[model samples]
Target: MSGKKCKHCGSSEIEVDPARGDAVCTNCGSVLEDNIIVSEVEFQENAHGGSSAIGQFVSAESKGGASGFGRAYVGIGQESREVTLRKAREGITALCQQLRLNQQCIDIACNFFKMALSRHLTIGRPANLTQAACVYMTCRTEGTAHLLIDISDALQICCYQLGRIYFKLSRKLCINIPPTGKCFFLYHKVANERAAT
Candidate 1:
């Protein structure tokens, strides 16, 4: 494409076949390029005369798909755990951004969520509750000037419910979070004053 011409016939008309991994010159009927690498997924014809994809779509964040945590196939109208986790992660990120938390806090919250997921603690629990608890844990551990009530208000959930989940998540994860101190409040006040100016 960058001023390339066929050596055999000096023709610039070329056709690329990604599936065959070759580029052919249209005018001269000669191979212009070969042994090209393709990243696309291959497909095959099924017995029912329909084309089916050859592989499953695995996410970079998913460690469970290849580890046999569960089957890769999901029935119709159902979703895989990886999809659920991805959605939960997006929700966590959105909530953190809305609260104007730093990236470190968001990363820590996602890590906590993953840990809770691996431990099977998220079973029988609401996804939003788990997400809120993870963010609260991040705030506590990272010494961020955010409170459970603040997170509850952002999520529009009851503060009591969020508090219960936060305590339970911390206990289950064996994380001993320090109580909110006067320095944290002062830090928030100073940060707000600086931002105002």
Candidate 2:
């Protein structure tokens, strides 16, 4: 099933609750169902007052729970939702440190990044460099505008180092991040579409 967006936060944090037959937003604890779907899909007004919350999806597959995205390792495993969420939060926080993103944005971005990478990469634990690249690419795609130089500085490496990271991640993930100019074109296309009726 497709991932549902959150009604309150306009985040794609919705997950299906089999018991309730409704999709619930894990980010803001919002229940999105029925007629609320229309408003939920609308762009939420934030300080930026734009479509900052891109229409994306968050599925159980993204979290390695199902849809055959990634397999959970038992070296450290949990059977409860609380523990899993805590672990995910912690991992995301560390990844944010690497990517220079704030905590709140990191969780959601990481969710999407992992899913996209899993859809293309081979089965294996990605290296730190690969993870850093995925995080950087994600931030760029999500409109963070953080420069690669700034990201490299935060990672305590040269700008070229992160470029290498991005390249290696692209190789490992088997997904090519389009050129910046191409990405700009695609972004404008989406923006224009959003601007039109």
Candidate 3:
């Protein structure tokens, strides 16, 4: 502590939450300071010799790194694109969770979304719709019990557009994921769980 004390309560007891970048007075439970700027760069050599803060901190998502979940790309629109991509990813992840999918299925749906982006399939489409369509496609390909109309209702995506994009994506990607068999869709609950119980 740089001999700095909380101005609110004049207390030395202060806490810093690095994740949220907030410094608070523990005694008064008041915010001492918010948004502490953490510079991304560790060191940099300017046009000369002295070290500077010009290079970025290489996150632990590189190959052979500890974070096997990898990094989520937010794309390159500064703030707007980052927010939009994050929302899309959240939508896909949430929908997969609702479907009671495993991590592998969620990963597959995320990949489908990424593939759609790379294929420029998102150019004239709503991001949310594309995101849900990706998850729906993954469930179909994996032969899960998710139905198209059900996914459409849950995600609030238009059924016709969703089906259209799904078929086009399948054709373009050469993915022949047949629609799930009717027997699998007979129940609205977890099929195997219900059977076992």
* Alpha-carbon local distance difference test for all models: 0.79, 0.53, 0.69
RMSD of each: 15.8, 20.6, 12.5
Compose the digit string of candidate 3's lDDT tens values, residues 115-150. Answer: 777677777878767887788788888877777887
Q: What are the clashing pairs of model 1?
A: none
What stretches of model 2 exceed 4 Å from their correct place? 1-91, 95-104, 116-126, 168-197
Q: Candidate 1 deviates by what RMSD? A: 15.8
Weakest lDDT window of 10 consecutive positions for candidate 1:
64-73
Kindly provide the TM-score of model 1 when superposed on the true structure, using C-alpha atoms.
Answer: 0.57
Candidate 2, poorest ten consecutive residues by summed lDDT:
67-76
lDDT, residue 106, model 3: 81
lDDT of 1 at 69: 40
Evaluation by TM-score, superior candidate among 1 and 2:
1
Poorest stretch of ten by lDDT in candidate 3:
65-74
Cα error of candidate 1 at position 178, Å = 1.4
The TM-score of predicted model 2 comes to 0.36
- Model 3 misplaced stretches (Cα beyond 4 Å): 1-85, 185-197
What tens digits encode model 1's per-residue C-alpha lDDT throughout 41-137?
7887879998755434344555534212423334322346666678778989999999999888888998899899889898888899899999999
